[model samples]
Target chain A: MSAPGGVLVIAQAEGGALSELSREMLALARRLADETGGMVEAVLLGENLGDSAGDLIAFGADRIHIGDGAAYTAYLAEAWMPKLIEVAADAPPAVILIGHDTMGADLAPRLAIRLGTTVATACVEAEFVAGRLHATRSCYGGAARETLSFKTGPCVLTIKSKSQAALDRNNGRKGEIVPLAADAVQTRVRIVERNVSAAAGVRLETAAVVVAGGRGLNGPEGFKVARELADLLGGALGASRVACDLEWCPASIQIGLSGRTVAPELYLALGISGASQHMAGCGGAKTIVAINNDPTAQIFKSSRFGIVGDCQEILPPLIDALRVLRDAKDS
Target chain B: MHIAVCVKQIQDPEMPTALLRVDADTNKMMLTSSVSPVISPFDEQAVEAALRIRDALGEARITVLTLGAEPARQVLKAALSLGADEGVLLSDPAFQDPDSYTTALALSAAIGKLGDVDLVLTGRQAADFDAGVVGCGIAELLDIPAITFARDISVDGGTIRVQRVIENGHEIVEVASPALVTISHEIGAPRKASLRETMRAARKPIAVWSVEDLALEAAQTGALGARRVLEALYIPSRDIECEFQQGASAREMAQNLARRLYQANIL
Candidate 1:
């Protein structure tokens, strides 16, 4: 853990390709490395990662450690932890960057414990301050931001998704690709089944516009108005934690502190009270429009425009008007 | 079977953002009297998950544990009222303002002191800090398997099965005893405590433990044991001026709003 080394990015492959967050991590690592005069390295562990290794280099990785096998396909921390440690041993990293997703949250702290290094999770901003890693993360359910620095080196970090900008692909970039030392390790935990819930349209994270429903909608059926608005806008539909907790919407689309964080161009909040936890997810939107009957609702505080009326009373006409505007623009 | 569920009490996360203020001196949120404290919502769900395990086994011991100030005992009482068998509060002057690492260190020591915990349950992330690392840290310190974001959990014989929520969907994972599983919101709402249980909880004796009780050194319990240092803490300011559209009717208002969005080039 004390060896002089560069930043290490752990790349996660989704659907046989490098995930967006992985690329973002590489970009952030590149920035940190450039500032500190260190090389940028990444570990890509999965089957058929030949192309992704190149993508990782193109995204700013100076070296790619490949663990290409079926055993690396599933995200079993017990299996991958040993491999990550092996990589770190070969080239001890000053900073280890991971995507602050499910896999990262599951692995970072454990890796820190094993490596005897400090770790930070869900960090939005990370920089090298006086040769130490300083990371800023949203806390207090996103009501405040806290900046923390490690007391020592080799800090493990889980970077929040969509916080860092990914560098443009540069096919001309060259990096080293080496095979990791293979080992057979026994894992006590097993993933028996994986069920992929069918997503309807544009993904919530990448959607340009998002229409979200909340408790003000009252029940499951009220989401139809939200769906119609999203459809008209050609965007994605989202929900508050309450909506998802009540089973009115899938938890996958819950936008809140414990759920997905979205930064769409336009966020249309329907009947949402804009609790701090919920705002933690959608606060990054360029523009937020809220429709809640309660004038004192918290959502209005963060919104650019607000309509203080019952969503049920105003939504149908609003949808109709938006549809008409769309049709007019189309014709 | 023995189950330990770790919970935390914090200023209600659902409190209005306007009330949130940072104490520059301490680099922490100013706990205002205007905001009443509540058990972290996800930790409540963790208590619920433990109760379900007890119900499934029909004869299992569930102990609710919390590491905070004395006020944290309130959360333990709430859990006890909801049917947990025992309550343990790790409270001491030396335990104040520990980072995630130290927090986990102290909690793991307490778990070891508990002596025979077969399984551990905790919220996916505390509603306040949202660190989501203590459960795994405890597992790491105890050298046990940890499964996170568990939506559903059940016990069968000596193994524990969990439906872990992932980015796309869920993955059903199984592990043997001596494991830690972090509960998620998909576990559904926790059951309410009955009036009789509430009264009974009022009389229940809570076991309070200190750093010495867990055999943890003061240096390894709080700020001294902290792995990371907080440099700054402050609320991010937002200044979006909201414009309300005026109209003779709801439809007119909707029309005006749409046109305004287009004019602003946001649509």
Candidate 2:
């Protein structure tokens, strides 16, 4: 029952390889493809994506569209957009999904404009309602959820990270790779240099656990305890928007409306008051554990477990005890 | 060179989540009167980016532009108070509730009507819809090159250098005039409009143009031009009943919680 046009998940390569979100997009695309009785297709736009098609196929893509070029090594919207549009126009899938991260934010709208279509950004979920494909996206800074249905086919979408669990890779899975040439174009915007300040440790989006600190931590010094706990748990350390704005931590690790959205298995919020904007980002956590001195903090309402205590005092013993538990496991 | 900055006024994004109401019948989130509207924070950043160019250029004209009803003029004046020279408001009943595509259509039309716009600026995304599309949409419509998510920007002669904020580090992009740049929160903290400037802004006339003035048909723009429609909007309910841990001391509490977490295999 395969349809003429399948689902296309635009895969982005960061530092010359496919990003983690691409896997998640494939996961969601596979789900939607199953629901629509269509094939799941993926397109990789990069410089040298070696054997990426095999991995993409193993993950869920039935076919791969590879757009390779030196210009695509680093993302230049003008350089890569035309190629993507060409691919989309050729396959003209029923739906096209892109990650809502930096690349997608820059590329999706332009593609929509070029294709004479519209796009939905920061979508957390997707579904079919009344026999039409609908994307559920966060609105009003995550205070409200809105479902939108595209008026035209091959709807362009930018998928938010951490919205779906990535599928397990199966190298045995079968898929076909079709290479496409994306011509480079001269444009007003020229990227002279790219200096990436890589985030400290584990990737927040893929981490099973996250330890985030907020302004209530008082100062940057307080993040030390949060960091220790994060390290002990083998997870990523995060900060709320205010803490990031206050320069207590890097902006990249901020967990809030404008920052990265994470839905880790266990989200431990330390000294964070849980503003709606911050909650909007981490609302997907399987278990939210809040540790703050203020018992009345809003985070307590959403947390599955709450501890009314100072993070500075509680975290040290907690970390030590967790270390002891690890020691026991090793013994 | 004259630069136009697109700004929007949205129901306060910082409003507590519980107070935000959703009307099931209309499938819309109602903007309650309790929380007054404010300029989307990033749009304020966009105004700041324009003001910076104006500062460096000695006496460049900065025009603040917006597409909405009358109340939008207030936010436009807020930009004017930040050292903009003029304000252009695109007001029409047809402009209400348009998605970013239609919104961009109207704004680009207004920008085109303004004529000789050397540069354009917009917030990375509107705080309400949280769709960061209008800036690029306008660039596409106007056929101008766009640099998005700029953390820092500086203009030299006809070329502008923007330290674009990407996921990892940053990229130093150089784009020529007749371009557009989208401002993110990373674009330095926006300065508040001073009282003297705010009072002076009250006297400055803000020009209001409708769809007719922009040579745009009402039916072909705004809601009609919107490429997508909101079918339903609601709050996802949280059903978790938190388990509050209590103990004689912090150490005991930590110990008990660790034991329970370990027992549950979360550890």
Candidate 3:
């Protein structure tokens, strides 16, 4: 086998387009590749993701490898692992980056196991120093950050979403796209059903402004205020793990280290006490605004701006004010 | 039907943030050493998910499994109190420092040793490691169809229907028996055990298995089998003091905050 040198990203696709996390991982890969003096490549697996290769290259991929198959349509750890391992063997990259999403979470550890490495997931930052790669990931439920390094080359990482900026697309630049087929795929799982949720407004993962509510909102009924505020601002609604645990919101909207990571321009946390676990997910936001009744809540430390008050009393007026602002901007 | 539910005992996540300490030099997390360990909240939910399935199916045997030190017996006992039929604990000094992969390898071996499992259930991820890997890893190792992020599951004869939470929406999937499923928080909390059941749980024998008993190769089961190395662990230092808006009333604070957000260009 050839000595690994370049960085390869597993560009996972959702809804025909590459997932936002895949693009973000590409950005990180580009930075790492540039720092380490290696090429940034991507491996995409799907039946009809052939056109998405352009997007990958535009983001910084020097080469794109597509392993297209009908069996590869849905995310099954059993199907993608064999193909990804073969891809790495065929062109051994020094670093293999996979997004820490649902599919990535399932696929990365198993792939790392197959390749004789342990995977570091939910990594917020990574750097290559003197040819050694270091990753900083949150552990202990986001209360602490753990920096990891491989004893050998070919470190596999499951990157957190929204960790880096995607490079501006340049149609002028192009890279190599290689089509490879898995010699064999032993798949046991089948996606008997597939559904794409119709989000009322902006998607939570990519929203520029996020309005998240926590247990202090009291119950599922509390989300009505949050949803109204989100709609008025054209933002997205998110929930704390507590709210999700309490069945106040969908687990899909959980905003924490264990859930989705968002780097929105502005994050308005309503009634959240700002647990380290929750802050780990929203730490990347340009400006975090936290609202809680407790004056000494831990979340206030992570927030750039905080309002100490009852969300029940404050939210309605806040929504009214936002409506006035939106109405003014529209006019 | 026979089901295997994997659970773990973890440092209490609900401890006040001030009580948690990080040691970067040793890469260690100190949780005051006073917070009693409890069943990983998610895995506890998984135990409940299995019991719920048993409740629906009727006459199903549930085996609670854990791969950790002797203290992990508590997680098994917790599962038993919730009505699981039996318990299994995999413990050995060599099993120390097993990454998610090695952990999955050892757990899969135990499950295989148990034999005739109609379904395997575990939390979406352990709260301690929070890697969310072992369940799917076990499925891959066993070559069984695995469903994750399951909100709910219902069984009919030998078929299983699961409602899975996807990225944005929910999808209901149907599968044949002998499949693996990782229960998410959406499964609802496990049933609370009565004092009577808790007493009976104390007497429930937990079968302990060692790495040698499971016959797992050293190259495949513990620190020797791990792939990644931890270099450092630390609490990230804060940067900027949080500016709190002062107002006599909640409505006044809302108004001040709204104007301030506009001035800060965060609106």
Q: What would the TM-scores of all predictions be?
A: 0.96, 0.96, 0.91
Q: Candidate 2 on A165-236: residue-level lDDT in tens?
A: 789988889888898876677767898999987788898988999999997787888888889889889999
Off by over 4 Å in 3: A1-3, A14-16, A35-37, A67-72, A151-153, A181-186, A219-222, A245-251, A320-331, B23-25, B217-220
Could you give the CAPRI-style class of model 2?
medium
TM-score of chain B of each: 0.96, 0.96, 0.94
CA lDDT, candidate 2, residue B106: 92
lDDT of 3 by residue, A4-51 (tens): 388999997766777778888888888888776789989898877746
| Superposed Cα deviation of residue B177, candidate 1 (Å) | 0.1
lDDT of candidate 1 at residue A256, scale 0 to 100: 80
Model 1, position B182, has a per-residue lDDT of 94
Q: Write the per-residue lDDT of candidate 1 for residues B158-215, one digit (tens) a residue.
A: 9999999998799999999989999988888899999988988887778999999999
Q: Which regions of candidate 1 fall more than 4 Å away from where they truly are?
A: A1-4, A181-184, B202-205
Q: What DockQ do the predictions score, one after another? A: 0.76, 0.77, 0.55
Q: Give, for candidate 3 chain B, the lowest lDDT window spanning 10 residues.
A: B23-32
**Can you tell me which runs of candidate 2 are displaced by over 4 Å?**
A1-4, A14-17
